[model samples]
Target: MQPSEGSRIVVGVDGSPSSHAALRWADRYARGVGGAVEAVSVWDTPSSRGWSGPAIDPDFDLGQARELFERELHEVFPDGLPDGLTRHLVEGDPSEVLIRASEGAEMLVVGRRGRGGFARAVLGSVSQRCAQHAACPVVVIRQQDDPAR
Candidate 1:
């Protein structure tokens, strides 16, 4: 079936190795599916308040975040990324942003874990939430092994 304009694949990146892999995978899938890829990164302003603080900064630096998202695209695709590829920086909880974006996406791709220090045996909160609530299929790419495997 032909993918709708809103059916572009969405990948979440946090400048981490696993997220890089997700970008690469999403790019390849987009090409094969004759669709575009969305390179998305949700940046929140660091809050001074305790755990109940808002997820994103009211004055989030969108420009810098966009640059980082584009840089990540280049790193994953190297020579170039597919045409129609776009990047976005939304301010909010990562899970909420991704889930909302996924409403129009053919699929959502994310790393098994994010910047949080945790074992691969579990998915990051964002990834877990996306997998549970996304409108489309979700792919969680695990980090590469340390070569001892």
Candidate 2:
């Protein structure tokens, strides 16, 4: 069953366990609804974001982001990718990029927390911002082993 136009499930992937769970959940939901999944992975140079962290080459960071995105997808779909799955590797803040992608989408899905330093927080900054500002409804998937569960 081909999904109707505009029935897209946009999901954010950050190479984190919770993101992987979100990806799997998005795929399953898309399949059940005959919708398509748009997986968005965002990256930015530390300097660009004024993080003051160790300086790194933008090219290398981009390559690493791409590799991580592909690895996560492969891990989630070991056999093969789903028929209606599409991937996007964008350069920007994760929340901002994902919010932009959420426009005209059926839903936006993200993980409760990512690789950010705030691991102990219930929700990561990206996920929180996405839930607050995305153009569509948002689903925040928690990690499988989250103690809050």
Candidate 3:
């Protein structure tokens, strides 16, 4: 089925500095365009814990994922979500969640959550994947040198 489009700008947030930057960017752009911002935090459990076998980490709780997402959002916007802004906690791979969320979005914003070394060599997997496959335009925010960030 086709995804429903809306005047919402979807941003993939992970609480990282880059992700926070992406959120700020999305908010600014959305304000300019008169669009609403949808801040999304995507997470996934260990594959080893899937139906194939018992979870390797017994302490892992699916509920914590939602809490973390909210905490991150609050940390960035301690005043609480701004007007026309909403939060979403999705359970799945980051790329998949963001891409799917973008289907009905005016645009998709993501941070280059790149880890130096091997992970970096992959070109920031989540951002790269979303940019390549998002149904709408994708903005990949990179880490910057800002004390406020």
* TM-score for all models, in order of appearance: 0.77, 0.86, 0.78
Q: Please rank every candidate by lDDT, starting with the best.
A: 2, 1, 3
- The RMSD of every model to the true structure, in order and in angstroms, is 4.7, 4.0, 4.9
Question: Which 10-residue window of candidate 1 scores lowest in summed lDDT?
Answer: 115-124
Q: For candidate 2, which ten residues in a row score worst on lDDT?
A: 115-124
Candidate 1 TM-score over all chains jointly:
0.77
Please tell me which model should have the higher lDDT, number 2 or number 3.
Answer: 2
Give the alpha carbon lDDT tens digit for every residue of 53-127 in model 1.
Answer: 557654556667777877877877778777888888887778889999999678999987677545323654788
| 1-149: candidate 3 lDDT, tens digit per residue | 33233368999888788988888888777877778899988655655435854565523645777787778777777877779889888776678888999997878998776322474356558888888999998888876832356
- The better candidate by TM-score, 1 or 2, is 2
Please, what is the whole-model Cα lDDT of each candidate in the order they appear?
0.79, 0.86, 0.77
In the range 1-149, model 2's lDDT, one tens digit per residue, is 45565489999998888988888889888888878999999898888756777889999999998998898899888999999899999998678899999999989999887877753254558888888899989999988733323
Query: What lDDT score is found at residue 40 in candidate 1?
Result: 84
